[model samples]
Target: MEVDYNKISRQYDDVRSADLKLISLFSEEVEMNENTRILDFGCGTGNYADKLQKVTGAKIYGVDPSDGMREKAKAKNSNVVFYKGNDKNIPFDNNFFHFIYMTDVIHHIPEIRVMFNELKRVLKSNGKICIATQSHTQIEKRFYVKYFPTTAKVDKERYPDIEKIISSGKEENLEYINSVTYCDNQLVKVGKEFVNLVERKGYSMFHLIEDSEYKQGLRRLKSEIKEKELELETAGGTLVWFKKK
Candidate 1:
């Protein structure tokens, strides 16, 4: 199931370009200050580190397992440290980070409790881990679900239920700050944006679908886009934060 991200890493930036505005949703919910030492766990392609650095002026560090991805992250911003690491085996010292956040990355982590243990180790007493992810319950809102059926199907299987996250937090004795689920503003785009986004093949869901199925989906998407402007309502995920006890 391990797709060669070394190849996928190359196109990662082109497709998942940093959206400060979108990232702002995370920032607003987390409410971090300039002095907060943030760890962007599972920082892929380093696209978000610099944008976050610009927004918060905090000492940010990005840790990822992929050297290919780490190299790109390092190249993105020197101020924001990027290195090879993961949740269970982070490179930095214990009680080192004030806040940790991951976007659209938790579903990929197989050992959730192992990660929670590591979070307990490094996160400061005042630190919090903020997770922005799509809950299985919200799958119906996924805008491309019809187009990318496998993506939705895979997500349902992969995405952890909200209760698991909350229960995991409790097991670790981390205080849950509550989880909020809200849909963001819809992306009203014409056909061109829709076509361009699909062509990028940056979405992980696209990787699951067969090539023939993907092509068929693209054709369907394009045809629909051409007929009229598409007001895409991408599914909104959940943000759950936990503070060290």
Candidate 2:
């Protein structure tokens, strides 16, 4: 699927990054020492790059296909190199990176196998690749099904199982050291703003939802929020981190 990079890029940080809980987990798992050469695959708007530079002293290169995202990242860090293209053909030599990362972008890619091999190719031996994506747990899928049914189907079909990723890495001669999964269990209210974003992004990705269904889902979500005196943040998805052996 060709993603509407323009639309998604405009609101990427506001609608998505604010509540991401996996940042800390990824930080813990991927230890970056000084002089670390990093490639942040699908580094939309450099959200993680901003933090990685501050915390790790790693020389970071961000790659994304979104023009809007590349512009924003360049504005933020004038010296940072932000490339525009799909991740599978990263414009770098083999064994050029000490670490690589792709956060919440695994499901968005149409070619997962190619990306896996490409990531392994560029990484130095004993380097690490940390990927944080949605979990394949019943509870995780169930929540999306109830709140955003149309989007749930898209995610279910696209997100590769963490185990599959680990195995693929091994096949490409990248040793898998460990995989850790986390789920944040908490109920937060869902408001109209979030619902609108859900509808826009979800509808664009999956055309299975009708206007009536979208309205009904919003109505139900709002009603539940009011009754529970809550905000629309629910249990967060799990983050799976794998290290290269």
Candidate 3:
């Protein structure tokens, strides 16, 4: 969906802050220390950047095209540098970053090829670029796909393919080192929290479809859940990680 991120920056972090598992996985894969320079690409509110900085004592940098998002991130932590940059042009010197991590924001980027080149340009030799994103293979079987059918179409068209990432990695001399799948749905009370989340329209995917469709799907979900009157589980996504060859 075409988005005006400045309008959503305030509420964005509230919903996104649900999972820290991705951050843990990143710390495990990317070697971190006091002197390490880390980049939180497409950082929404700099929440992860702030968390990472504290966890590893690394000099952290976050980049996003949204001024509102950047400002929010900067407000969270002044120590971490926040930049306004895009997919084709990341305003950084060559071999600048020891590690880079982007999650859930890959599909939103408009320039995949140029961004891949930019990644290669700024990333240090042997530095890992960890990408946590949705894959086409997972979409057909996603639990929530039934709720909002159009989401599958939107996601399939936008999400970068694994093979393509590997191909780009090969062309960029980056390695297709490792990858994994994650079931990211948070368990919540079906009657309350679950419905509230849907109402908040926290996910950008919710904004992709028409309001009528969104309500239709939500109504169905709520009806089904009120029958159970218990907890609900949602969202399934996959993650892929690559390294500099």
Top of the candidates by TM-score? 1
Cα lDDT, model 2, residue 215: 72
Q: What order do you get sorting by TM-score, best first?
A: 1, 3, 2
Off by over 4 Å in 1: 29-34, 185-187
Q: Between candidates 1 and 2, which one is better according to lDDT? A: 1
Look at candidate 3 and tell me the lDDT of residue 63: 89
User: Model 2, 96-215: lDDT tens per residue?
Assistant: 998787877887777666887888778887788887776666335445467557666565677777777777667766666666655555565555655556645533443445657667
Q: State in Å the error of residue 245, model 1.
A: 1.0
Q: Local distance difference test, per candidate?
A: 0.80, 0.69, 0.79
For model 2, which pairs clash?
188-231, 188-232, 188-233, 189-231, 189-232, 190-232
- Candidate 1 to truth, TM: 0.91
Question: What are the per-residue Cα lDDT tens digits for candidate 3 across 89-128?
Answer: 7889999999988877888877676777898888898888
Question: Predicted candidate 1: what Cα RMSD to the true structure?
Answer: 2.0
**What's the residue-level lDDT of 215 in candidate 3?**
93
Model 2 C-alpha lDDT versus the unseen true structure: 0.69
Q: What is the Cα-based TM-score of model 2?
A: 0.83
Q: How close is each model in CA RMSD to the real structure?
A: 2.0, 3.0, 2.3
